[model samples]
Target: MKAQSTAHRVSRTLLFHVFTAACGLLMVYPILWLAGSSLKGPSEIWRKVYSLFPEHPTLENYINGWKGFGGVSFTVYYRNSLVYTVLATAFTIVSSAVVAFGFARIRFKGKNFLFACMLVTMMIPPQILIIPQYIVFSKLGWVNTYLPLIVPRLFGQAFFIFMFVQFMRGIPLELDEAAQIDGCSRGRIFWSVHLPLMKPALFTGSIFSFYWTWNDFFAPLIYLNNPKRYTLSVALRSFSDPSGLTDWGAIFAMSFLSLIPVIVLFIAFQRFLVQGIATTGLKG
Candidate 1:
């Protein structure tokens, strides 16, 4: 019986490792392929497609991709994306955390009802609201500008608010009482006491906001009419040419480059990020 149990455990461990390795390879292959393709010349990309290593590697694609075809520079698009993403993400974190704190801590009439309504709003598809939002922004002459991207985040987002609220609920009310007894005001209690405790949740929210805003294509596409206002996602679209001059190598290089910021953000906050997600589910 002991021998059988040991054999069963070993078999399970082996199976788990096999599954993990397979999944890791599957996730990594596309990134590897893109990196290899980015180094290849246009002719080498199409002609020697099956080869994992480029026969003749070159950095010309990166140079050209950054510069432009005729008058469409990717550097401008990258700058626009960085600006919009940073501001929008910062606004989202602050607004969402404040709103979440109120929902979780403050006593108010219709608080439960309002929270219910907010949850229902989360269930509703964002696509349905885009048309109305576009109409309003257009009427206000905000199209072709960054306002459309940044302004909406100031009002507080539902998902981040929900995540923050859940995390705040997991923290004990005793902390608030202790702060209050020490003559701390509500603002100070939140800023000095609760805010430090919320580091994990804040890191998680900021990372999500950064990634989503950085990679958002639809919002930029609808609001930005000018090539100069394009985000990386939107800029990638410009690479598709019907004139047979589209540089797939450069497109792949820039696409991979676009992913680096999100990766760095994740790696930097990996510790807090893991804890945040775990604790979010600990409360109602």
Candidate 2:
């Protein structure tokens, strides 16, 4: 019986490995292909279309892509993206946490109703409001500025608020009560107890915000007019040739570079992100 059980386990393991390998290849093949294409020379790119590997690999594409021709450099666009992403993420974490705490812990009139309204807001498609938001920003003369990108974050985003509230609800109310019994105020309880316990949720929220703002194209294209103010997403559009030829190699290289920040962020906060989501929504 034991021998038969061991054989069954081995068969399952082998099957799992095969399934995992197939999935990994499906996901990684495109990235590998893009990287392979980026190393190929112009002649190799055109002539060796059927080949999976490049005939001649060179760094010339990366050099030209980084320095650019005229106007703004890739470095400048990267800096712009970094700045917007960091600021927006920071504001989102802080504002969303505060609002979530109010909804979860503090008792105010119509609190449940208001929280329900906030949740409903998250269900609404953002595409529906783009026209109204654009008109509002234009009316305020903020169309050509970063204000449109950064200002809304300070008002507490709906999705982040919901995430925070859900996480906060899982924390024991006894902790807040205990703090109150010790002469601590509501603000102190939140700052000292809830906030520290919510590191994972905060990290997750911030990472999501960073990715969203960094990859955003439409907002930046509509609000930013100057070449210097362009993010990496917008700057990539300029890589197209005058005669309609696209520099696929340069685009892939720049895209690979753009992914570095997000990769670093994930590596740094991965532990916190996992812990936060796991602990959150455990019990009221």
- Cα lDDT tens digits for candidate 1, 1-284: 99999999999999999999999988888877888888888789999776668988998778877875448787887788899988998999999988998999999999999999998897898799999999999999999988988998999999889998888898999999998999999889889988899987787788877878888998888888788777888877776555657677778788777888877887787776667557665221
lDDT, each prediction: 0.84, 0.82
**Model 2: residues with Cα > 4 Å off, grouped in runs:** 1-12, 47-55, 241-245, 264-284
Per-model root-mean-square deviation over C-alphas: 3.1, 3.5
lDDT of 2: 0.82
Please provide TM-scores, in order, for all candidate models, with all chains considered together: 0.88, 0.87
Model 2's TM-score against the true structure: 0.87
Question: How does candidate 1 score on lDDT?
Answer: 0.84
Q: Tell me how many clashing residue pairs each candidate has.
A: 0, 0
Among these predictions, the greatest lDDT belongs to: 1
Please list all clashing residue pairs in model 1, or write none if there are none.
none
